[model samples]
Every structure is written in C-alpha cells, then in structure tokens.
Target: MQEQKGKYEDLKHDELGIKVRSDDNPYLSADLQQKILQPRRLSSYFIVLIESGSITYHLDSQDFTLTDGHLLFAMPNQIFTPPAKTGDLKYFKLLFDENTLALLPQQFPFLVNPSNAQTLVLDNPAKERVIKVFEILNQLLISDKYETDTEIILAYLNSLLSEFNSAYFKNKGPVNILNTNLSKFTEFKLVVETSLTEQPSINAIAEKLALSTNSLYRIVKEYAGTSPKDYFINRLMAEAQRRLRYSNTSVKELAYELGFNDPDYFSRLFKKSTGKSASDFLPRQDLSGK
Candidate 1:
C-alpha cells in the first residue's frame, strides 16, 4: 500500500508537473481503487493513448468504453480511478500544461481555447503516428534537450491533432441537412464563443453578422434545434462550469464577472441550468482577492 504525505495539489507554476508512477503506486491508491474508493483528483492535463486492450471509464455520469487506438484525456481536478483489474494495460500518457497548446501553430484556431471536452479519438494508423511523436516527446522529457524540444513535441502533437480533427470532427462524409448548414452553423458557433463575454443578444449578433434575426433563427433551428436564447444559455452554462471547476471565485463574484447584475438571479439560473446550487460548486474556503 502506498502512503502519500499530503493532498494532491496543482503544480506551483503554470508548468505541467511530470511524474511517472506505476498503477500500483500508493499515490494512485491502487488498493483504494480495488476497494472502489477513489478520492484522488488529477493535478495536471494529460492524454492517455490506449495501445492495446480495453477499459471502462466513468466520467460525469457517463461510462466510456475505450478500446485499442482510442485516446482518453484527463483535465485538472477531475477525479479518476482505474478500471477493475484489466490485464496490464500499456499506454503512453503525456502530461503537459496549457503552454503545450499555446506552443502549437496559431493558424489552427481550434487550439486557441482548448477545452477539456475536446477529447480526440484516433484510429489505428493515426494512433500509431501520434505514438511515434510521443516517442520523440518521451526522449525530450528524459534527455536534457531543453531547447527546441518543446517546439518539436508541440509540432508533432499538432500534426496528429490536425489529422484526428479532420477525420473525426471535420465534415468529409455523408452529405445531408448537416452538410448544407455546416458553414452558417460554424459561424454562429464562433460568434457565440467570441461574444459570450460581452453577453450580446440574438438580434445584436444577427445584426453584426449581417443577417436578420428571423433568418438566423431559422438556420439555427435547422442545425442546432434550439432557439437563440436557449443556445446562449447553453454557452453560458459551459462558461459557468469552467469557472466553478477551475477558479476559486465566489458565486457573487462570479455572477458579477459574468455580467449578471443580481447574484440571486444568477444563482437561480445556474441551479436551473446545472441542477446544482452555485454554493455546491464553489469551494468552501475563501479565496484570495475575493
């Protein structure tokens, strides 16, 4: 049984903390895992590339069955536990910081705001190539090849992601209602992401985009199957979860930051959207600068 001295903590700097430990290591608490008690929270951003075999993962009330050539991503503070006794699952898990994506080519706009939800699943051929890149990254991680090493790894990862995104997310397949509406829908998505901070209205966004609100609504309904207000609320929900999970800010402070005038209204809206009280998400301990 492995015994750790202190609680798991995020890295001190804005750098990824790298540590290689076996599943049996007490820090990972293999015994607790066997007993179905997993209190450990991930302290860094990482990707686990499944080389062979399969594993079941439970995340946010969903069960994901990951097989060979599949990739799993873990974001900071997310709780995880090993699957019940899978035979020697071997994979290359790369742990890095936000800087890793920042170092990627800026032309890939999707990488600009990398979200934890953006998990990439690669097929065999694609997975092999990414693993080779990781081989180079593994060398860089171990050897004192400090200069240009990060750049090299970043480029390799970008290449892998580019191909994976094209295959899995990008439209190259079936042509139908979705294909016809992809461009406009994508533009709307971009507008939502860019303007959520400003809290613009549907009519305002439609005006800015040079389209009438009714026309935009029709297109959004065709593709997204929701009204503009509902869509905006969905976007706001995502931002709220991100803040609640990552930041140590209070509910009132977060409400103000999100441009909500009434904290109580914000709390009610948040609970309606997430089915959990804002206080349940906010850390109990007071945060600095609050």
Candidate 2:
C-alpha cells in the first residue's frame, strides 16, 4: 500500500534530523507542511512547546486542544498530524530521530511509549526555561556556517531534554536515577514488541526484566500510570488500531498476527479498550500498508 508518512531522513538537511520551527523561522514550510498535516506517521520524534495558540492537534487518534504554556510530544510510527489550521499561535517545534535521541544522557520515559498525558501544562518558570533552551538550539541550527557543529548542537539538545525530563517527572514523587522507571519500562515495552506473535504473559515479561509480578506492577504503575497487564493491552490495542487504519489485514487476521488465539475474543477486547469494534472502524478507514 501507499503509506505517505514523514521520516527524519527525508526531512533533514543537516544530517542531524533536527528541525525547529516557530514564528521566526519557516513556521510551516510549504515543502513539508501539507504532507505533515495529512494523516500519517512521523519517523522522527516531535515536541511542540506552545507559547500561545488555539488549535486542535491529533496524536494517536486523540485530539488535543493546545493553548498557552502547553507542550506536546509524538513518537515515531505513531499516527499524528500537525494542527489542521494554525491560529494566532506562538510555539516552538522540535523534531529529531532515534540516533539523535541517543545523544542524550537520560532516557525520556515519555518518548518510550507514553501511557498518558502527551500534553503537559507548564508553569511560567518551566515554560520560560523550555523557551530558552529551544531558542538556543534554534539559533545554532539556523546559523549559516561552513560545518554544522553537531557536537555543540547535541550538547544543547541534551540540556533541552534534561530540562524537559525534570519537568516531566517533577510530580512523579521525586526521581532518583533519571532513567529509573524509564529504562525498565522501555525494556518491558521491548519484550512485548518482540513477543507480539508469542503472546507472552506478564509474568514472562517480568521474569525477562528480572522483576517479580508485584514489582513489575508497581514500576509500571509508577511510570506509565497503569498496571502491566493494562499497559500491555493498551499497547496491543494501539497496534490493532494502526493496522486497521494503515494496513490491509482483516480483523481476524490482525488478531492472529497479534497472537490472539481467538478472533472473537480479540474483538471483544478491542471494543472494551477502544469503545468501538474493529469492524466499526474498518469501513471508514483508508487501509493501506507498506
């Protein structure tokens, strides 16, 4: 199928996959804006820090009304579109790839399959700090130089992530290591992705991560704000949604592909999690796949 999605390699010019946009720069470049606004997945990760704006943005089939002091994040392979219309908005948008993400010292738990609250309302203090970091990187990126100082850019990028990371986890009851729950949560997520066809149980995942079921539950709850079983189910449901919208697989085939022993059971679980049967979404969706 023809999957018209945006990837960092296709979007980058400086080899960093780092693009920043605001009122100052090309707010929405003609070359990329229309494709981005279309219903497609992004290959690069994105963050939008809204200084002031009134627009509805969709991420993973959910609509978010962005306004003053709001920050939004999107991960790769996720169905996302920029605001259909840009209002009298002042915001900074940052996009980078997984390689660029490895530059940071910390693992942003939010980037690793954020369970809830993709948009955060920041206070003035946090907002100002985020704005400053964005400004610094913006200046460096758009600078006309012989060679892109990728190292320097990565340094500021790391700081930007650190600032955002601290703010992201501020209310999570005081973090010890920066990647405490984040790293384990990522490991847990990885285990599920690899075993999607195997349909591994929660205990198997916990064992792989060297944690007991209880510890796994507590950690997942603390980090993702959901139990491990619920978190896994949500992940499965999201994949099912993606397939329904973007692939040609029938619901029954999708269930089998996702390791469900029975298509009928998968259908029920889909309705419980998403409030609509797969069949309900199929007819309205534009199904295509790579």
Best by lDDT: 2
User: Least lDDT summed over 10 consecutive residues: which range in candidate 2?
Assistant: 1-10
Score every model by TM-score: 0.57, 0.81
For model 1, how big is the CA root-mean-square deviation?
10.1
Model 1 residue pairs with clashes: 2-26
lDDT, candidate 2, 27-50, per-residue tens: 456757655666777788888888
Angstrom error at residue 54, model 1: 4.6
TM-score attained by model 1 = 0.57
**Candidate 1 Cα errors over 4 Å, as ranges:** 1-47, 53-65, 73-87, 94-121, 145-154, 170-172, 175-197, 207-223, 241-251, 274-290
